[model samples]
Target chain A: MSDSRPVFFVSDHTGITAELIGKSLLSQFPGQAFTFVSLPFIDSQEKAEIAVRRIEAERARSHLRPLVISTLAEPELRHLIAQTDSLFLDIFPCFLQALETELGCPATPALGLAHGMSDAGQYRARMDAVNYALAADDGLATERYGQADLILVGVSRSGKTPTSLYMAMQYGLRVANYPLTPEDLERTELPECLRTYRSKLRGLSLSAERLAQIRAERRPDSRYASLPNCQAELQAAERMLRAAQIPIIETTQRSVEEIAALLKQSLATA
Target chain B: MSDSRPVFFVSDHTGITAELIGKSLLSQFPGQAFTFVSLPFIDSQEKAEIAVRRIEAERARSHLRPLVISTLAEPELRHLIAQTDSLFLDIFPCFLQALETELGCPATPALGLAHGMSDAGQYRARMDAVNYALAADDGLATERYGQADLILVGVSRSGKTPTSLYMAMQYGLRVANYPLTPEDLERTELPECLRTYRSKLRGLSLSAERLAQIRAERRPDSRYASLPNCQAELQAAERMLRAAQIPIIETTQRSVEEIAALLKQSLATA
Candidate 1:
């Protein structure tokens, strides 16, 4: 009996690039159950044989040809992997050749260089941004508010922390988020520090029902997680955002990537 | 003169997939100062027109043709964007057609569906992993040790936290990390609790010089940040990991993505 649940992402490096591309493509066909198998750092012929055997075994057992999404840079390794008894989708060779033609220059086939520590400065900046986000989370690092590239404010569970962390990790953007508490919402205006950085402020909001459900998971059946309380808090937060005249985004139906990308676009335009 | 610093990642949806691919490709060409502009959610003809105008303006001002890496799904929008004077690399069309040919199926042109909140279960699981990572950071949530998918042990600044977060965010893996304190390193045997879950443990180690440099940035010249102290701590941690017979990877020259992928591979194989 063949199991049709395993999907392979193989690469000579971290396999992240291949996984991202593979996952995006697989997501379009969403009904199938997928068990993602990441085989990274496959830089040798021996390792490539192991991967081929694994894929073959999966194919033999499942009665379905397993899909292998590969980003291997070396021609010989890629050729070897392509010989597996499965549907192979090598992501790099096609695009790399086309890009070489477009640029009229041969690309340096560098292995393990896609996401390595080649740029120490950029790595440090990213780490620093991550630390800043952790410190400034939930209005804790108020003194460093001025250093923030963007200040996101919203009610709890509005998807602020993840957005901030995504921005920091992906773009090295220094993001600080403050949760809108009852005291802050009681007053009709934004916080004083937020006012000073008003131009850089972003707001996130979600559906009251969704907010209540999320909070219920954390603290069940309390006033803090009640639907009525969610409604009132959201109403106050929306009113404060309107009073401030800042750009607000709804996270009810959007993913964290969408929210972060929207914020990045606004920052570029501003 | 057109500005050469701006690089645009254009997409009809979240633009994250395009940005990831573009950033990975661009990082190969080091020494170029690049400013990234993400133009996401361009679902309408009017919005596409706005994006074209923005690209043209950048091209006209900078005197250099701007590079536009796009992931637009709609044919009309992709065709419209390719008409711009700038150099364009549409990431989806080139591969989608090939994939369609390979799969013997026509892909529906679905806009904004790649990274949306369509799978509530998967989204919730990812978020739960994130919350779990945060709660279990620095040995804080010891009660949930049995629930962890992987336990990472390392000295401070050995790249445990970010790796844990990346695993949770990218792959929805519940990761808990414990810093090997001096007290723990002074002991001969593994911690009592860790011994129970030794099969699920992964270790991280880094070069003493690099570790010292990273610590010096956070806390300057103190005993905890001193080179000798870092050397001794790392030596002790490495020995303990060896004595415990758990797998360990060095983070001295690798990115968080690489470390996480290595661990993921180990998990899959185990």
Candidate 2:
């Protein structure tokens, strides 16, 4: 019988690279049962204990050993997981040790920049680019909006947040977004805050029908969720964006993949 | 002069895979000018045309041939992009053709499977696993959730929606998440909605301090954004999750990659 149990992934940063690397590694073992979990950041011993206990319980139920992949495995975390009778793989420690042996430097604090330009580095860059793109001038994001690689503007539920994040994680672009409010539509002008960064601005527009569907889920009976209201808002927003010469992409029916690709293509050529 | 322009990535789903694949491909050409733009989905031809026009304008300024990579290459989109004097690579068609040749079977429409698992047999198995995980009655997310290969959950601002999408595009996991709301905290119970799925339910918790910081940025002086309220909500939520015996992870102080890794580990062991 296949080992059909699951594995867990805990990390202190983007768990994606590790997940991909882990999955690629596991694909080599077919018919083996596995489970996967991703813990974002375990900076505290208490949280680590909670994670360890959960892993142990899963192991007991599945009757299989669990594998853990992580970058922030403090001693306390290790101790907690060690109590569980499961195989643990701490990726960063092993990587650090290997790098230390090669470079004669202690691996106390992992030096991210020391690693040469790698695929991972490129990924980070892409993430930065998307983060830059999503940032708006309203002091809403982690980084400064002026430094954004691109800016997205749209009405609520037009898929701005997800799109902006996708840009960040996938391509390392710094992205920011501003929701076009009713006031902005009525004024028929871009938000005053967006003017300084107008050159980098891009717009996301969704069909009124689609926007209504999305908003209805969040606010079932509000005028904001009605199709006619959505249509009016969308029309006004589009006109304002066009007057500002901001490029727009409609997200009514396309998949997220398609939208990201289209934006990337447009931005690349731009 | 070195081509040092930033790369952009936008996506409706997780943009990680495209960023990774794009970066991998770009690495083959050193010191090349490149930018990645990921737009999650473009539902309207008019919006696509606007994107194309922006690309043209950018290309005119850069004075170099641009490279465009996209998953969607419908004829209209292709025509719009063709107007730009740049090289375009439509990834999905090529990917689909390659898969068709590899699997020696015709692809057909199927719902709820990863794009990579286009093969009918594998797709069916994956769909079954996902549906089973979703339909699980226990709060434990179960091996099915572990089998999910991807899962996401969090409070409103902990960034679960974006992160789940990033995982799906990058790792092709059938991801799902259930929010930990104030009601859930008050009851100190995992959503009866998630009970049967306990084993598969990984928790996403952000630091109370971080949650306050994030909330403050959005709703500066509201009680919900107050430090005390943030702390209380976080404590209550964490306690509820713990009492319910669910696995929990904090999402503060980590990048997207780290989160993806932790989830991958959990899924592997699940």
Candidate 3:
């Protein structure tokens, strides 16, 4: 089957939490198919009623109990959505109650605050970090490197740009990535600019075969995309980073989110 | 009172679901101080034991129960972390059991599958989308716009680039953004390239004050950053978009996540 099990990620804010948790749960029952819909900005009774109707209509059409994972924060709206006879999974009500009991205060049930412009400072920082990632990508031998929270170094297609952008976008990290050139790999010593910011450096390492596959997408059949060239560059880059005591992340089989999370955890533990 | 409350988001995979849910729950309780850490890649018994020890150490130092929100998939690791005796929030266990009973099948438990390279096709699509966003940014009247899934059109600093990149990175959408210059805003008709792709156009709308503030960060004291210029350009652009029946997203008070989700919902419903 396809995405046709009629899954709804209902929430008061952006519905991101509902989507994340719902998807995680569904991934476990891999072969079971479900069509997911995220109805964000459902911050009102009217919208909640609409969501209930949508779910009801799905139940009528599919002749099956639809699945709903709701992160609705308001008690009233939560009850309204729960009125649906579908297999309702109220994602956050019990947890919020537990948290409130622990914190010794009731949660403030405000709308659109969980992941929106309510925190202007954090929002601006993330935007600024995205701008920094765009500006500081590739060979930037400039003073702007000083402002970076971290610098990623790797040979081409070793997963620098996407990782830098992901860290910046998700974690508000000012990440700059410098691609290790063939000349930089040839040199016995580490690049001069990178040496100055050695403490902020993290190396991204990937297998030569994977690197060639990626490079082939851009410059196919060229010597730069050759397996031998990729092997040599990766070997030299790894040796240089190891010699300088820079921690390296093997990104051959990891997604951007995985790379960013592992790297963030390393920074936190370090 | 800052990031010092010793909150741990432990997971067997990327920890993103744990982080997103944990942060959402924490955000509900305002003014409660906490420093959160995401310890991803916790797939082994050794890592689970280390996490327990870390939580125990935090409990010893803070003299308060540390908050732990774990998404560990393995039942054994989950049991191991449960021994910590802190204010543990095992985020997924209860939900997973409920889902299993609902689906009439036992979940095939595994580590590091929620958000990683386990689905290589989706991962490659996201990377390709990011590359597409980079290649198709700005007034790209090029033939490459034909390949775009969606095209965002707005005045400078009205939030086209960030939205494009965010959509590309998060939702794996090939988003291409086109900046409307003074000349395009002055014209009665939409720009030639944009007119052809009117069906895919999304307008990002924001107040003049916010636009001026954002532009000031890039080009301070310039006419482009002046309030009047911002006001005039936004007015003309909004009118032009309305004439063409393009949906405008007011991004002045919305995060990138919210905007992307809302846009996605519109697409799904449409």
Number of the top TM-score candidate: 3
* Model 3 lDDT tens row, B1-270: 334578898899888899888888888787788878777888899988898888888888884578889888888998988888577788877888888887888887767577877678987899999989988988664578888888998998888888889999988999999998998988968888877887788889999999999999899999999999999999999999999999999988789988998887767776
What's the DockQ for every one of the candidates?
Answer: 0.56, 0.08, 0.77
**Residue by residue across A1-270, what tens digits does model 2's lDDT show?**
555656676643344434543453344344344667765555577877787888878878875566665545355665676566665555444333433343334544322211123445564476445435434422376236667777778887787765666666555667787888888789976777788888778889988887897788779999989999999999999999999999999766555544665677677668
Give the residue spans of candidate 1 off by over 4 A.
Answer: A1-6, A31-35, B1-6, B28-35
Q: Worst 10-residue stretch by lDDT in candidate 1 chain B?
A: B25-34
Worst 10 residues of 1 chain A by lDDT: A95-104
Q: Which stretches of candidate 3 lie over 4 Å from their true place?
A: A1-4, B1-4
Candidate 2: residue A193 Cα off by (Å): 1.1
Clashes of each: 9, 124, 6
Per-residue lDDT tens digits for candidate 3, residues A97-150, read: 888887778888766576887788988899999999989999664479999989
Write the residue-wise lDDT of candidate 2 on B1-270 in tens digits: 654433333222334443543443454344345665554444357766766766677676664555554434355665666566655544344333433343345443222122333234553344343333334322244344544544455565675644554555455466676566667677766766567666766778888887887778778989878888878877887787788776777667555545655676677666
lDDT of 1 at B156: 92
Clashing pairs in 3: A3-A34, A3-A35, A4-A35, B3-B35, B4-B35, B5-B35
Q: List the candidate 2 regions with Cα displacement exceeding 4 Å.
A: A1-143, B1-165, B168-262
Tell how far residue B204 is off in model 3, in angstroms.
0.9
